[model samples]
Target: MTDLLTIRGVSKRFPGVQVLTGVDFDLRPGEVHALMGENGAGKSTLMKILAGLQPADEGQILHRGEEIALRSPLDARERGILLIHQELSLSPELSAAENIYLGAWPTNGIGLLRKSELNRRAGEALKALGCDVGPKTRIGGLSIARKQMVEIARIHAFKANVVILDEPTASLTDAERDQLFATIRDLKARGVGIIYISHKMDEIFTITDRITVLRDGVVQGTLATGETDADRVTQMMIGRKLDAFFSRAEEKFGAEVLRVEGLGRRGDYHDVSFRVRQGEVLGLYGLIGAGRSEVVETLFGIRRPDRGKLWWQGRETAFPSPRQAIDMGLCLAPENRKEQGLVLGLGGRDNIALPSLRVFSTFGVMRHAREQAVYLTYRDLLQIKTTGPATALRTLSGGNQQKFVLAKWLCRKPKLLVLDEPTRGIDVGSKAAIHALIAKLAEDGLAVIVISSEMPEVLGVSHRILTMADGRLTGEFSGAAMTEENLIRAVAHHAA
Candidate 1:
């Protein structure tokens, strides 16, 4: 397998930020090469350069052994290159077939768009991508995994020799991820060169042949996958060794703090029953669309449950909105952390204190110094990397922004905490810190519920794990028995 793509002396810079500099990279035919880095490590920048999403400040690109200047994705396509972005690009109203064969449509004998030809090619492309979505089904109704498959199918339909998947499995379930990996393998077998960008060390080691690490706008190093472990990769990305990231903290149980019975939301989930005692961490594990989020949302009053009874500290209650839920000492950190977690344009301190602004208000006058003090506490506590409490949330890294969101919730000092996909986009170091913080909170007698798609996460932090499939509680796994294989089997057998 010769080099199918090569980047030499690449560099990029924004107004106040120099994102990438003097980067070198190459991709061989029939290989799954991974890109690794922390959130601000220039991985996205380099990928944008390769995909023509952004032009290089100074560099030369060689595709298929020929020097080329790609000004747009269409130009890159002419060079047989395809990019599946971390943020998906699919029309929600369009059908899978329409999305796949969008511009280059095959026509019928009558010179009109051929429906049969569209479905046939779309179906074949989806099959090769290991996706089972219906060709004619509307894209909006499909799961995130299936939508990602649609994107991959569209790229595969182009028959590009060089394919780039940027964090493609970030939102997918384990089984769905395996299906994606299988598709990558098939592509490699068919002589397509692949660039896989991810922060997940396990997946990279398992699937990729080689890896390139970027840090602070420079190439850290490239290493063979067989020659490194998670620890080494972590060191390479950060230029230092990290400590242990998980701890099975001793949890103390108190009286039931949260109880739900016959919880049912119309067209969502039904008859969900659970209780979380003070100092308890309840792990909710489910594949995408498995109602894990719906159950929590109902608890948080994001949606009205069709039928159910909820008790806070054994007192029957009903919340019609998140405001009511917050008043009752409950908080939810939603899935799209960037979108729902923080106000991007606001200062980090302001975002952190926004949830409980009234607390920092004196006689209807806002106390700026008070909010600053609170932000400084969490800024040091979470080790958030920013200029100061006054820095805009958008200027911070993804992990730091997440910490700010958590800080906002912490300012409220809620009795019941609901973290949905809390560690979704964070790196290993931040993940460890967050998990440890969750455990510490639980030990202090705050009832906690963690809704996650990550198997290891559910197994790691929860004393009791509830498995959801579709919109129902299918099974419950105990603290000691929640292995990866069992969890996979449970999800597979019960997933809707």
Candidate 2:
């Protein structure tokens, strides 16, 4: 019953922030421990310390009754501990076998690489994790789910005793997640301990044995998963009672804001047609690579349609570029917020003002005061947490980054808004706020389109739901017909 690893009195501090304070954690063999926290609740700090990415200001880590010094990630890995980050760390151009044994490749006595042995070992490791991917397959060519499998296979190959997985299922599909759970169970049977960190309540309750909650850099408490409920866990993390997670307003559809007829983008999506009405939220639901994003991208002029027609307020219109779409009163907050929406090096004020610069400028002269006022308005409205308006966007958490992306498009006062994976990678509290904001935007008469992989989100926020599969619209449902079962059936009905 002895713990495999234990953290005692851990503390970490930055210039203006105390990220962790007297936090303690433990991991036992064959156990999956859940780490729960809000966006800025010091969970990442603790994990980084465990992985030896950064040294704790004051703390001690014990392994099997003996204190240990973890000076670097290499030290931790050598001790049979591995951390799989939310952002995957893999060489995209390398083959699966090469990446599996990246720094520790097999070699012959003459110092030449042993390709056959390497591939055989990699294939065995992948098979142990129940993955079917070929060892010679390129890492970049694999899907996110397959890439995750490869990551797990690497851990198995390394014989890691303790594995730290951060948001492991963030981008995975339902089937892929089930596969991952099977792999986790296999690891558990093999006596490996897992440290799981995620914002999803369902996942935590389903997979974890014990739950530890952190708030404001301190440990609130730890409880056995079977003995505690989600309500208690949420209260512990946020120190407040959360209102209903999903807040949907009354449905009141207005005149059609956009109508697409037979929209096709050759290899991406084809024959996609839908209509969005003012003061209504249209939810697009599908599996990954289901052409949902492509449809919205075409509408926002990010992709040109090979054959189709778009009608804007009853007038046939064609937007050759995103700028043209913006000029025509349409804006898209893309799925990859960091890569496609915000400039990480820029400050919050600058990012929110980027899309609406013309509104604050006159005669090609910049208006600092006006821009600041607009930025402050959105900063307050979106409840963006930052030390100052000038703080770099990269310094903010994932949730706040998403809020900034929303503020950028909201500031434009566009007639139609397209939000793709708007709540991906955000915490529960932030998700509720964003959901409420989406409802409010629709209430205020802005046509909205939300493309999300989360079924609950799509069902809760949309007045209507459209299902896509294999680059085409498979089905549409609304009102009482939009259950999860029906949505899944619709997506699978057109499967190739």
Candidate 3:
């Protein structure tokens, strides 16, 4: 197989940061090349250069043995290159056909719309990926998986030779991910080169033909997927052996801080009963749609439980809103961090201080000195990489953004903390850091409840694990009983 694209000596520098340095990468026709790296490791920079979203300060991009200058996104697209970002760029109000042919809609003479031709062309593209969705269906009504397929269909419509999929399976279910893998195989059969960027080790090993590791704005090495293991790849990306990535410290739990009895929220969850102790790390594990989040939301007062009782510090209580929960020394870090957890346009100091502003305020005026002191404390503790405290939260990488979210709640000094998918979309190093932080917080006598879909995360950080299924607590395991097989069985077992 001949090389379809070759990148040599790629270097990019921002105002205050050097992104990529002397990087060399290549791709062959019909091959899935995996780009592996931690947050801020120049993977995104290299891909942006390839997609023409950004220019390399010094490098040469060769396509089909000919050097090409991709000065703009349109220039790259004209040469058969397409980049599908992690966040899908589909218009919600438009139908599948309209979105696929957005700027290039077929028009009759005199600028008249040719609806039939648009649908036919869109349908042909979708069918090529084994998708049966009607072209007239609205994009917003489609699942995340289907939306991704539509994006791939657009690539096919453009006759793209090189496709870049950034974190394609980040929000997909197991079955939907399998469908996407099938689609990728089809695209491979048609000789399309795929540049896959992901933090997921399993997906990379499963779908990619080769893996390229990048760290600290430089290339670590590129290895054949069949010849490498996850540990080796991880070591290359982080520059250290992660033998104890999931290690947990011994903990001695204190008195019960929270107790729930017959917690039921109409259609959401029912008969949920659990006890969280001080200095305890409780892990909640279950398949998606198993009411793990709903239970936490109800506990945090996001939803009212029609028939239930909560005992806070051994006293019966009710939280009608999140403010009430926060007042009662309980806080929740939601799963969807972008939408619910952090204010993107705001700076790190503003976000971390938002929840605990009262502490840094006098006579309804914020004390800038106090706020800065607190912000600087957490910035160092969490190792958040940012230009400054005033830098926009959106500018931080996923891992750093997550750390700021944790800092926001940690500043409040909550008695009980609920973390939902705390490590989702973060790199391996960040995941380990968050896991260690969770264990440390628990060891410091803070009651913590972790809700995660990753088995290793739950097993490694939690002193005990609780399994939920169909809106109810099904099983509890600890110590030697918290194996992956046991957890899966507990989640899979359906109760009458």
Candidate 4:
């Protein structure tokens, strides 16, 4: 079959960064081609050029063997190209049908709204995707998974020939992800070429026919999926093979630092209990809506618990607010880092110092030198990549952004640290670094609780593992009992 789209000699540059360098790629009809790379490896830059969100400094694009210029997003869309961003792009206040037919809603003879026709077409699109979401339901009221389905249905309704999916499964449950895979197969059968961009090795291998690797704004190589294994692709992505990526020497545990009993929040979680000790890493494993994050948020006092008891530092305590929890040496690096953890407009120095301003100030006066010193300390320790401390947090890649979030809390020297999905959208290289960091933090006698959707990650980093299902603790494992099989089984144990 002839290639559907071709990109040759593509390159891009910013003020002080060369984002892409002479990148060459192509896509064939009916193919799921994966674009794999580290956080700053130029994947997003290339995607932006294709979507006409930005112009390439130097490159040539061709469609059906004829040169083409995509000067705007409309040009790309007119050519049957669409992009689904990692951060969804649907209006919250609008209903599902309205979002699907947002710009080009059906109209009558005098430009009157044709609500029935719009709903009928939207219902067919949703039905084709096997989604039961109500056509008139508000987008804000729907789950993340359902919102994604609506996005896909929008693309389907447009009959897009080329689709770019960036980190599509980052927030989906296993069942939802399976349904998405089925949809992808259907699209592939219909000859819709897909540019799949993700950091997940499993998804890439499972769905893609070809794998392409980029490193530091350059194309490394492309390989047929059936002929290449994950280890080889990973080695190409990071310039080296990862051996025992989660290997660590076991450490001895200290005295208990945190304990929760009969924790409950109506409609969120119930009867959840667990304990964390000094110098111990406790792993929490569950599906997306399995109450893992809700339990942690309650523990950090983000939400009031209906019934529960918490013991901190051997004293029965209640944290009615996050400030009280932080004052008690309990801190959390939340799940959604951009919205909940960091201030994007602020510089690295400011974000790192935001939570610890009290320590650096005296008599209501600022101490720039002390703040800089602390920022530099954690920046170097975490290996955060940036031009300087004054660089905006949004300018950094996902891995470095995550490292900064860790720095923001690590400088406070909290007694018990809670991490929710620490490596959710980062690359394999960054994941290994975080796994190592978790082990080192435990060795230094800090109590840590790691909550992850990936079972391998939980098993690799934790000294003990706890599984939750339907808002309750289902199983606990340690030593020889911690296995993927057992974790999967426990995660499926729903409440009766």
Across 1-496, the per-residue lDDT of candidate 1 in tens digits comes to 5589999999888767788889999999999999888777888777777777788999899987789988987788778888887767788898999888766678877879888889989988987777879889899898767788788886678889998898888888777888888888888998999999887778899999999988888998899999888888898887778775665558679999899899998789989998999888899997888898888888887788889898889999875488888888899998877667788888888898787878999998999989888988988988887776666777666777788888899889899999998887677777888899999998888889998887778788888888887788877777567777667667666422
TM-score of each: 0.87, 0.93, 0.93, 0.96
3 versus 4: better TM-score goes to: 4
Tell me the tens digit of each residue's lDDT in model 2 across 1-496.
8899999999999778899999899999999999998888888788888888999999899977679999998888889889887766778999999988888889999989999999999999988877889999999998777887788787778899999998888777787788889888888998999999999889999999999999989999999999999999999988898977887767887899999999888889978888999999999999999999888888887777889988998899775488888888899999878778999999998898888778878998889898888889988998888888788888778889999999888888899999999998788889999999999999989999999999999999999999998998889998999899889888997422
**Candidate 1 regions off by >4 Å?**
101-123, 342-354, 357-377, 386-397, 474-496
Candidate 4 residue-wise lDDT at 297: 95
User: Is candidate 2 or 4 superior in lDDT?
Assistant: 4
Name the best candidate (by lDDT).
Answer: 4
Candidate 3 lDDT for residue 14: 84
List runs of model 3 lying over 4 Å from the truth: 112-153, 494-496
Q: Evaluated with TM-score, which candidate comes out highest?
A: 4
Q: Mind sharing the TM-score for model 4?
A: 0.96
Question: How many backbone overlaps does candidate 2 show?
Answer: 0
Off by over 4 Å in 2: 107-116, 357-368, 494-496
Q: Against the unseen true structure, what C-alpha lDDT does each candidate score?
A: 0.84, 0.88, 0.88, 0.89
